[model samples]
Target: MPESNNCCEAQGLDAITAKSHMDESIKPTEPSLIQQVIDNPTGDGITDTNLRVPEGCPRIDPCPAKAAIQTQECETEKGDGDNIALERARNAPPGPLGPVPTGHGENVPLEYWTPLGDLTGTRPAVENFSLSRFSPNEWNEHNKKLSAACHDGIQVATTAGFNALCSISRAYAEADRNQMDNNIRLSTRAGTIHRWTVELERMIADIIEEIDLVQEVRRRTMRVKSVLQVVENIDKDMMRIRCFRMDNDLVRDQVSEEVTKELSLCEEIRDVYIRLLDQIKMQIEELITAKRRVEFDWSEKKEAYEIETESRGLGSQSDTILWKAGSTRIPPDQSSPSGYEYSTKQVLAEGYTAKQRSSTLRVNVDAMIEKAVKDLRDQADRVDLTLTQQIQLQEQALRRLEAELYKDLQQLSDTETLIDEMHDASKKLDGAMKCAQTRLDKRLLRHGVENCRDVPQFGLIEEVKSLSESVSATLGQLKRAENSTSSLIQSRRDIEKEMVVKRPVILTVPYYVCDRRSYKSNAQLEIQSP
Candidate 1:
């Protein structure tokens, strides 16, 4: 009972000490280094002096350590108490000199008296007797208990220490791993930002170069238009000169024809130039639009570079790092990586295509203007030369027509003969068809099963179909032949009328010559008089 009471008293003292420790630990004081680290994990404002533990501060170890220490101290106190008790028993006086009386009738001093036996015949049961007094001293038993408790406490302390160590080590390892991953993420992001910045720079330069080239093309296009305008003015002057002649002299002559042709050529060339200008203008506008997009993207790239660079600068020791709300989440309208790259490529491609087209147009502009001028100056001579050639060809064609007329007349007679032949063949085919049909009709006269299609019946049916088709084809050929005969006769009549109309008269050419000479003289007189 005393041992149990001592154990309970020790536990009560331990609890009181623990409660007092808790209160002491919770007492407000100057901010500790750990609290500082939590508030500013980067340790930006911390110093080596702050790392030293303060005097009188409670130990920073976990709860189990303190509990184990308290248990060991309690066991030591218990052992000390047992030792004191043994010393007291060793120094005490001896027991009584002789055996005391059993009080069943034995003589004994009253000071060592015994109680009377039960008068109702109630005696102690023999089975209830115990030899615990003769077994071992209470002190020895208590010592054994204290020794076992000390051993158990040692095992518990060792296990708790192992668990605490493992937990702390794992925590430190995880923290380091997280830091490494963060560094890698930031580094990779920075590289991406730098690469995009370089690409944007290149795109911007390309767009600017393209813009310059397109402007040059525009200048060339304007110059070509100006040259075309000058050519138009020259054509106008020519037309004006032709108009100055009197109305009678202004008759449609070679000079007037040549001037009109040149004016028309000049107008056509001007129209081409005007359309080219419009195309160049449109190309320039397209290039400008592409340039704007590139510039905008370039600016965005610069901003992204700045942001990434700033992010890379942030370190564990950086004071500026703070929790930014929604920073980890993707924002609305943000483009994906592929979308960004595609848009950039589209912008560059548009610029390149526009610049290439502009260059091609600029190159062709000179060639087109040169060809137009050459055609304009030589067009009238070529026309007069072609007119002469056309007259010769017409004469040749007239002669060839006379020859064709003779051939056509012969062909018409042949066609009439063919038509008669076709009619005769058609009649022959009709007779053949009737003969085959008569055979088929005779075969049908067989009764019942004998009327079935035999070899001869099939042969007769085929013959009848062949003959019918032949007759149909012959009739169609005869009709076409008659049509050809009619067309040939009409062609002959037309040829005869054309030959008569084309027949030259001796006075007609001479009169035409006389009229041309008179007309020329009149025009010359009017010009000379003016």
Candidate 2:
């Protein structure tokens, strides 16, 4: 068998030599190839070649051809015998600390499966299982080396695992802290936005209330204006009546004069009402503008509240929480925090100012309305009182004139009767004179001495003269009585004409002014409270 092995080895060597020479002859010769191999012995550089031998270097140890041939020849020559030998080698017991392998083996605990005891300085009972050829010291040293390597590997793995756990735990803790901080910030921001929303709501309410009040004041102004206009018209009518009086009757009487003054007062009141109405309208406009601003601000606050609430709802792990494009960048027209606060403050301030002004305007309007009504009422009362007094005086004068007229009429009748009686007496006297004259004429025919100065003729002449003077006195008295009657009639007519001019004024003032007052009171009641 040894001889056959030697023969196989020689044949394998010769075959390798011949094959190598043949490959060398077939390939191209390059002088730099040797230098390339020398520079990169493992061919692990830029080149793809593996380890190479120089031209004159010895052949590689454990030649592949020699081993192959040896293995094949041995198998051909003794197949069953080689199998028995291999099985026997496998069944052999290992040494104290396990088998000392010379090649790569299974990665398992060979010492645990085989032996874990000290080496004995004794031979094995079976020659095939003997470990006499292997030095115990060397096997122990190998076992110790392998155990140390495994322990070192385990220690390294454990340390790396612990460090990885600590690093991961720290990362989780940092993420939790970050999330907590973000939540706190969101909560604070939402709270601030909510507060702003509440403030806006308050401002809006104030503006709305102001607007309502302004509207109410406007209505009141209109009502007051209507009342003033009515009063003014009545005064104008009274003045017109006075103006249309007859030229002689257009005297500046107390009633007419007072009517003119009342008209002027009415006109002044009307002008005041007009001014107040204008002011009310302007105030309404301001209130409306302020309300609009408050509403706009309230809308902004509402939107901000929603946005903040939504933002607060987002979480790190939420699917909806995503990266927004350019989210970190500010808009061009975006206001800063201070500017935003200032703008909000300005809106609130304007609304507050409008509310204050509205309140003040309302107060002024109320005061003006009260004053105007009071003034007009007072003036009307004064005029009514003066007219009543004047009417009473005129009435008294008419009564006196009537009484005087009656006396004058009676005196006139008595004077007329006396004049008639005096006329009759004159007639009788004329008859007596005629008869006496006839007697005297007859006597004169008898004797001129009988017509001479007799006592009877003298008495007849004196009686005729007395009767003539009484008739003339009666005529004078009758003329004076008729003149007095004419004067009394003229005074009564004047008093009646003056009463005609004044009676309508007294009627108009109290009734119309009272109606106006009632209307104003109703209007005030109808107005809504702010």
Candidate 3:
């Protein structure tokens, strides 16, 4: 077996040498183990042994002679027992523990094996053992690294979640704040509206109050006007009465006329004059009462105003009182004795003096009597002057009354004619009133009011003036109130607008991120649960 192996080695070397020379010009091609085995089966039992050859060789195509010889030789060698040896070598258990079956051993080059030893058993158990054995620990370390990475991812995810939550919360807060701001604005508007409304109401109330006061003042003014009108009418009637009184001859002539209409008219005029006088007297009394009341009120107001003005240092000097008789003085009286009284006084003095002694008497009786006379004359002249002044005043008053009486008489005649016409008109008016009253009564009866004729006839001119004045004053007051109300409303609108137009601002807000890729990259975990 050793000899056969040696001969195979020698033959392999020769074939290598021949092939090397023959392939010098051709590209060298390495053979696989299977191909080497098929080409040189008889040369070596191990097909992967390196074939040796000489350095130089001729390219000779040896014919069938060398091939037949080599074939016979190979046949004889196989018959000798090489087939059984090759079979035993192929089937033999790998030596010792044998070559570990490395999964890629078939891909190893057969040329890499040696022919001297059983390299099949001697080859490395695994030619290229993977680093997989150490991989478990590496994988564990990798897993730990991965776990750390996953932890970081989870932290990132948590951070992203927190940031997202913060953004959402901020948005929600902003929304809430906006809503709150809106609500506050609305509330503020409502408050402003309410305040304006209240102010308007108060203004309206003030206007109403002012209107009421003005209306009341106007009503009193109307009453005063009516009273004044009545007074004027009374004055006219008094003048008519005076004129009638003055024209006695004319009245008498008219009274004696055949028609008797003037007489009847004069009677009616007299009666109307009397009624008018009474009415005028009553109206005058009322006016006087009213004037007295007004005067009293004015006096009170004036007094109060004066006191206030004085306190305020606004008083007038014209209010001071003065007297006209400040310098008048009366002198002492000097008088003279009568003649018989003087003689008696002298006899008494002589008797008294005869008893005492014979003495001459010194007397100033003449001067005393003269002074008395002068004093008496001055007093008489002063009395005469006073009496004369009083008489002049009386004469002036009487003359004025006489003139007034003459004017009154003249007017009285004219008024008598007017009165006649008025009486005739009154008769016609009475007829009309009766007719109207009858008609009204019929209508009133239909409306269930009985005895409608009991309704009094209204005085025309008096009521007409009173009513007209009342209506006029009332309308004036209404106009003033309307103006005041309009002004108040405009003021309220301005106030409301000002209130609504003023508000405060907000600051310091955050922004949010909404990119999916950034969220995923930063996050360790998926948002959707695995």
Candidate 4:
């Protein structure tokens, strides 16, 4: 205490016992971000016991006339306690209602008043000074020479201190949370854009091979070559699956797996159909050749039998049957030479019997030829039906492919649009950042620091730094979108770095409301460190 030269005067302690801590003379000021971060919640510098606070704390009466005055030796033992400064600050003018009417202009608050206790040194015109008229009375009635109004010794009322601290702390904490959330949101958006761009570009690259396959299939499909009257029904399919990505990883995996499986099935079906068509063509050709052979031989034999019967005075026996249209086979029969015919029919009676037997043979063979032709027609019909079904299946597959391709195309279109939007935002942010940088450079130059490192940073410098960081992050994201597949985790780290600026944001709003005031050049106006 060292005699506590800065102790509250007896005349100035009355308001601490009567009014609010936020006195009119002491307007609320912004909470200092630095202070809040450092101010421990453990306790204020005071006794822990509640009982020792408002009432039981030692009374600091500086008045020499007070009956309970402590000895000088007792004051020398307490050391230089800050309570001396606190008490003086709490009770000094301007009074709680505002500036007291001094013979001079208004007196400034003690905290900002220079030279530690004398205000007349700064403003020589002020006359009714509080320092000159010290008194033991609340109204200075002990002398009745100074003003009756006075400030309080309590910076905060004991009963209301807890609530005020809690409210202010909450406001700062809320601001911190909001700023952190904004940083997180920006990171998430950046990551999403990056992931989509990478995925889309990869898909577009992969699609080249699929397009080639489709073209190859198209070249071979439905083509009949080399005079083989063979019709081909090849299944041609191209699968393209494009989808807009979301944050749902599990869903994306499932969709990707499913699309791959279905496309594979389409290729397998195409292969099976191609093999089936080849087999069917070979089988049909064999059947058709057999039928053609049987028809030709039967026709030759039937004509000979009818001629022999007519010459023997017997009625004509026309047992010949022709092959049906669209026959898939040819007969293998050949005409018999004259030498063989005569050798087969020796002696007149034997020849007549042989003729009858020949007629029977001709009829039997003709019926066989008709049966072969019927079989060929039936097989061809069945193969045609099967081929048609296969063709229908192929067409259906093509349609499904087109649908998927359409979706892929739509996804590509959407991704391109998103990329464009990102570029536009990047350009806008770049321009704004450049402007902020110019302003910062000018400020630094004015402060005689060409480099930002040499200057002491304030709100403007911090704002510029913050904008630069945000711009850099966006540019990084755009770069990744255009050409890189860098992990988005880096973006998250960038966001965390950005969050460092969030702390000061907590006190910014309150400062504007509580500390903001118009410029005043009055000698008594306090010069705050804004």
Candidate 5:
């Protein structure tokens, strides 16, 4: 505990807090006229060469800009610092926690520990202890109090102390486990730093509170209500645990540095995340647009196809019966020609007969419409399949992102695993289609319709082109993310290796004061005699 306390004090996290505050208070220096014009153009044909500039040089028309060399501009959208953040985030970790808030410089507030209440025993004062302070009667009284309190009042403290230790230990362990477990999560939208902050802070706060509680018992001022008061003071307690105490400061800083490295990686991954997310969204929209085009256009195609089917007298040829209205003819049920069932020779012969005909027969509208419908349906199916596949991929990427690439970004095996998981979303889409078909089939029967197959009208040439373009864009975005993620993962590994410090385990607190005292009754007396 003392060692931990000493490290915290020496590390001076308060100094970090003070320095950040000072940095925030300073104003940005305005760029010169030449520099402003040079930095103003984003190469999008947009330029701002205004010579008259105000202090800090507010963004001018057709140009979005921040001061080029400001330390505070590290996270600016187009700043070199942000460009460098992709690589240099871990080089200079932020103080307290989180990214620097825009126009604000508040560090993470420290959290406190609360002790359990109604402790009904006294702790023998150990301050300035000497032989004179422990005469025979006083020593006996203290011995009894230590023994009685050890069993009685100290049970709560012991349990509380160990509980805090176990809690913080598990909290730390969980953080490590999560880093591994979250590898899959990093690939998807569900990935976040919020979980890291929440768990890390709780563990650190509990450790600080445990330390404070130990200090209290050692000083012989342990009281349930006082402990509650300390814990209840949110701001003060938070400061005590998070920012002020030396022990608290060191552990927080050490853990914060490691976690900060992780956060930096997450930010880099987020760069690819934004691009990938945007690309995926565009792809999904294109697919959805293609699907809707099919839904509306199919009805018209179906009508034309059925008309042509009837014109060719295919009613008698189909598996299901389809009769035209006002035709009083009751067509006789025709069986297959004798001995031709299950015989491929007969079918081949029929095709040869048609081919061998001397006359050049005209191509029928029936065949033409059928071919068009078939092609349309094929394109629709392709759109649906590709759309589903892209969505699954996006979700998987977010999953891996949330899990963190550090855990799951292995060379080839992980890629295969992701590809293997690709068929699930399509299956779900198929089940939905089946349900729709069931309902549609009933509606058709009620309306006196029969043997009409679903088809698409116009071939979705424009939509297909659009969809293809979106898929290509999405692929490019994903490739970039994957490539960047690979490098970021390696960087994270390096940071952890450099900054990680193994935390010591905290066991239950010592109970009886005499358990730590000398057993010889005359030892104190003899020392005093000297």
Candidate 6:
């Protein structure tokens, strides 16, 4: 062999020897990266160096066909080296790798991996190895891109969340507004109900008062009717007695001294009867007048009572009516003339002139005189008898009249007593009404006149107070019920909002092993691994 050739061969063998020694060193230490990553995956110094070749590797000696042989060997070795690196990477735990050199172990560049383990030990070499190198500037640039993407995603999610929250808030606000409106409606309804109730109560009270007044009026009328009936009965009895007396005196006659004396007695009796009849009639008239007066007074009082009751909204059913009858003396009628019949002897004794008598007797002498006198006497006696009988009947009628008069007087006396009693009763009633009015006034003064001012002469204020209290209590209860109902409705709405409406959201990425040929074929690659 030539010296130069030998020298070249020796140099080539030396290179080979150095590469072999380097390969041996790398082969033994290569597994250390995997072990180190596995033991402490998140350790600060741990990296992807375990998948990369070491600092030294075996090389070939030079030959006459060294170029071709070297090329073939290089191609085979490169293929084998890539396979070994891929295998190592597949088995190696994931971490940031150091820089990779271009030619051999020195060409591997540094790379980065996230905390989440993303490597299969058999990962292919990146086609853009320079692009894959883990320079601080590049890493920062990648982090910025990732941060931007994450920020965009976060912004989108936040926008969506904000819109959802706004929608929910709007719904809640609308619901609250609706609830407020409902409450307002309920309050209005309650007010209306209270007003209606108060009106109804007032109407009812008015009706009751009117009914009571009617009843009171009815009672007063009945009382007055009874008193008037008594007066009518007394009047009828007086008329009957008068008629009987007049008829009895119309059918009697006689004339002797005894008859004349009896006639005188009858006349006296007639006078007494006439006087008695007059007294009875007078008494009747007086009683009627007094009763009318009492009725009139009662009517006036009733009117006053009604006025007061109406004005005060009070009932006058308990008021009373009182009446009485009275009597007066009756004067005799003096327009009609009266006369007495006398006997012949009685007439002569009255001193008629003798010439007149002689002339009166000359027509028939003694017989004629006797006949004329006797006839006159007979006529006179008949007249006397008639008069006497009339008088006697009159006397009996008079006695009956006197009895009627006495009865009438007694009735009048009783009526007077009744009148007195009625007057007393009227006074008492007046006093009571006055007292009631006074009490009412006092009550009004104490409680204020707003309620009672409309009443003209109202009676008792206690009654009004009681009625008002009842109405107020009822109104209060109605208000309470309305409030309770409103509250219940509000609570129901709140429950619905809380329990039936309003829910959280979750995102994922997957790990993939890339094919080196596929990665190398394109400048940019999109892997669809789901």
TM of each candidate vs. truth: 0.39, 0.58, 0.19, 0.23, 0.15, 0.20
- Model 3 scores a C-alpha lDDT of 0.38
Encode model 3's per-residue lDDT on 1-530: one tens digit a residue: 23422432443433345444435622345334323433343444542245432244222221222243345345535565434433443454543223222211122223322221121222212223321121243467657768999999999999999999999999989987876676566555445434434433443343344334434433433333343333334333323432332211124232123213322333343443344335334433443343343344334434544454443332223455345584455534522336424543453343333322211100122232233233323432343344345335435644554555455545554554555554455455555556655655555555446434453424433444454555465555555545554554555454333322211000100001112212321131121111
lDDT by residue for model 6 over 1-530, one digit each (tens)?
A: 13322322333333345445544655664656545544443454653443463444222111122233235335536554544543443454444342221222112121222111122211123333322223344467568869989999999999999999999999889887876676566555444434434433443343344334433433433333333233223223322332332222222233223334433433443343344335334433443443343344335435544554443332224255233244243445422212111221232222223223222322223243234234433543454355446445545654555565555555555555555554455455556556666677665675555555555434255544544555465455545545554554555454333322210000000011012112321111111100
Give all candidates' CA lDDT scores: 0.58, 0.59, 0.38, 0.37, 0.36, 0.39
Worst 10 residues of 2 by lDDT: 112-121
- Error (Å) of candidate 6 at residue 88 is 11
Clashes of each: 0, 0, 10, 16, 25, 25
Ranking by TM-score: 2, 1, 4, 6, 3, 5
Q: If both were scored by TM-score, which would come out higher, candidate 5 or candidate 6?
A: 6
Candidate 6, residue 16: the lDDT equals 44
Q: Where is the poorest 10-residue window by lDDT in model 6?
A: 502-511
Superposition error at 83 for model 6 (Å): 2.5
Expressed as tens digits, the lDDT of each residue in 128-150 for candidate 2 is 54422323444675577689888
**Model 4 TM-score on a 0 to 1 scale:** 0.23
lDDT, residue 140, model 1: 70
lDDT-best of 2 and 6: 2
Please name the candidate that would achieve the greatest TM-score relative to the true structure: 2
> Largest lDDT belongs to which candidate?
2
**495 Cα displacement, candidate 6 (Å):** 99
lDDT of candidate model 1 versus the reference: 0.58
Better of 2 and 3 by lDDT: 2
lDDT, candidate 2, at 178: 84
